[model samples]
Target: MSGTSGSYNAVTWLLDRNVDEGRGAKLAFTDTVSELTYGDLQRQTRCVANMLRRLGVRREERVAMIMLDTTDFPSVFLGAIRAGIVPVPLNTLLTTDQYAYVLADSRARVLFVSEALYPVVKDIVGRMPDLEHVVVSGNDAFGHKKLSDELAGENESFATVPTHAEEPAFWLYSSGSTGMPKGVRHLHSNLQATAETYGEQVLGIKESDVCLSAAKLFFAYGLGNALTFPMSVGASTVLNAERPTPARMYELLNRYNPTIFYGAPTLFASMLNDAATKNERAGTGLRVCTSAGEALPESVGNAWKARFGVDILDGVGSTELLHIFLSNAPGDIKYGCSGRPVPGYKVRLVNEAGEEVPDGEVGELLVEAPSAAEGYWNQRSKTRQTFQGHWTYTGDKYTRDADGRYTFCGRADDMFKVSGIWVSPFEVESALITHPAVLQAAVVPEADSEGLLKPKAFVVLRPDCNTDGLYESLKEHVKQKIGPWKYPRWIDVVDSLPMTATGKIQRFKLRDGAS
Candidate 1:
């Protein structure tokens, strides 16, 4: 929080500060395969920086990390920033073609890919003319320069870069409403800005806490949760490199006993529905849990608290704003709402005419925060539209109450009128999730027999649920819970909903296939 003025680097604030405070021997990170202490992290970070420099990756140049959650992640990520090199952490789950597109777009000079993921990017490596080296992390480097070889001769005594705080630090590719990835550039000051505002003010992250996040490091939410927030206060983090399934989550929870856990809404619902975990308490030492990526359904939130004895601090965040600017914190929480703006941020609900709407009306949400991204890379028009002078336009639709609580109303393009009134897909889905038989739900507008747009549902049911007379039962349940006009006219029972790699429901796909 102190040094963001002229010459500041995030490495000194997040990693080196802990070492200076005499937490050098304390565990900084414990991954599935290895653990790293603060002292080890500091030394490793410097070595990585020297390695990048030796590889001829110059200042302000790009390096891509297609890595899993591991102890090596922080060393590489912080090392790049410390030496004035930009590190782009990409989604490990992307296809080879997607990887090629992003690598070419960013023009990354070196790619540090994990050994397990080498197969995916192997064939595409030749197509990248700008990509100079393919350094593999694990053993069996697969005929490429290994990361250990690059760091072996390097000394752990590199000087930190005296880059301006407003200078670009890194880039995160965001697949906005169009589903195309564009590089979102963030400044050196943005990391600590989010840590101070949301991490310090809302979540109250501390040194004694141990953190676990089902959200991967590739995401903005995960970066703040597992990396910046915990490291900001000298806390420890547990990183899981494998899939975060229900059983796997419980295994980690029982083993590490993380005090703060971060996950998406769908994961929470599935965990609650998993037969073995139905009556289970939360992690023995869990003080709090967080839900993001999508709005938390009321039924899921209330049920989780009842069973686990902790609250799910459901909040709204994006790749553009970096982390949760609007959130439901510990005390002033309501299940279905995205609480309020964090202490250092501001939000507004604007109508189509760009005028701020009054409370109780739906409008597009815009946020004013210190951590907002500079703009999209190579997207001047979009950057102008999204990052307006002082406010960043969020593509979400929300309604505010008199007390400043914001309730999600689907996406701006997803809302449609039923009976000449706006219908929030989230509202209908929340109602559907309250029913005993329904495990998950997605609602989209479909043409009725009369050719009018009406609510239609796709639901994933509980394993023990009987399907006989189920559609009618669900219909009546939703009608009684919300209102008659808001109930779904048709229901399609399905095994799973279509989801993006980021865990968001691909409603546009459902709308395209609507009856």
Candidate 2:
């Protein structure tokens, strides 16, 4: 298969060769109980692709997918790619209003939904004027077309539509931490480059490995780590339809004995909390574990290693970059640092003037990588602001040590002034996590009587900690760790921290709830 020059897609590169040469390799999908192999997967995807074309899906059009992390999800996703339509996988957990926002923002013509979620989207789908076709993955509900029936008698060998390397292949919505979700568009070449750089350099995945992640397929980190990277290496993947609770995740790990475990810091912390008895249940086949989305504190890294006997390689990536841009690889693992930049990518810390910051100084992180997205869809102003020259400003404030390892400070927007001194919420939050009594913490600026913003913390206590008198103890703990000014002026001990669908702490929600 010659490389596509102005005519290549990720599905084309991933499946074409396999269908022709490596047809016998095994690819398994364990949704709830049933499992399917690579051969079965290929045939099913082709069948669905044939159905999609017959239903009038055309090249370069958008097809929205709103489903859980089931086996059928991947089948539909790859099938859409085969049919020349870009798959826009939306977060299944989004509210009806949020779903409506994304549907309007992307201008998706078709929507593929799972039977389980049809009720949630059924009433709202009628209002989405742009949606013309509805395909259901399981039992037909609300008079929608059955996914299995769509390709019941179709051919399994339709040719993929020719596409340029620079053409949009897929769209992933931004976290919308600040406001409305923006569509982050990526080219076919960007996906391929992600496989080449991070897949090869950081993950070092092999065909013999079995990949699994707690991340849902909707998020780019999960989609790439769970599907694209493993498929690129000819490795099989395990997709759990259920939410990734620590117990369920351990079951998948023990059952399949996956070689690579990819997840975020919150998931890692959950696993550590369950490690007392679950460690012995872990599969010996596991070799590498990775954490992304947010910084993995040194304490969490050390605790995980002590229990699982494997280092958790931490990395930092964004929706704009599509995948992990900076990561510590297998052997040269750093506990706290979100490693050096992956091969073929350059990272810089710049001040407000866009000048390079001195070593050990905190500044905005900017990345120049081939895998970076073209721009946010339909938002030209943001696109221009985010992508300047060859670099994509990450909006993450960080400091590089003398040894060149990047340490996450906090989001540039999350930095607040306390007593006329700048304070990073991440620094305070990370320090809070180090105490055994704290599970997770989010720090925000709460306005005082004079309308002056001061640091306040919302803390989730660990399982063993007593809730009584905990707030004062935590405040004192912070006072001892950093200084008098860094201590939270007010502390709210909560049952849990509110998080986005992708597991990021919704600091804005916490801040709003404080008042």
Q: Which candidate number has the best lDDT?
A: 1
Local distance difference test, each candidate: 0.91, 0.83
Each model's TM-score, in the order given? 0.98, 0.95
- Candidate 2 has its poorest 10 consecutive residues by lDDT at 274-283
Query: Model 2 over residues 124-206: C-alpha lDDT tens digits?
Result: 88889888888888876569788777777789787777777788888899887878889999887877788888888788888
User: For model 1, what is the alpha-carbon lDDT of residue 58?
Assistant: 96
**TM-score of predicted structure 2:** 0.95
**What is the C-alpha lDDT profile of model 1 across 298-383, one tens digit per residue?**
88899889888889999999999899998999998999999999989999999999999999999999999899999999999989
Error of 1 at 417 (Å): 1.1
RMSD of candidates 1 onward, in order: 1.2, 2.0
Query: With candidate 2 superimposed using the best TM-score fit, by how many Å does residue 245's alpha carbon deviate from the native?
Result: 0.5
Query: How many steric clashes between backbone atoms does each model show?
Result: 0, 3
Off by over 4 Å in 1: 279-281
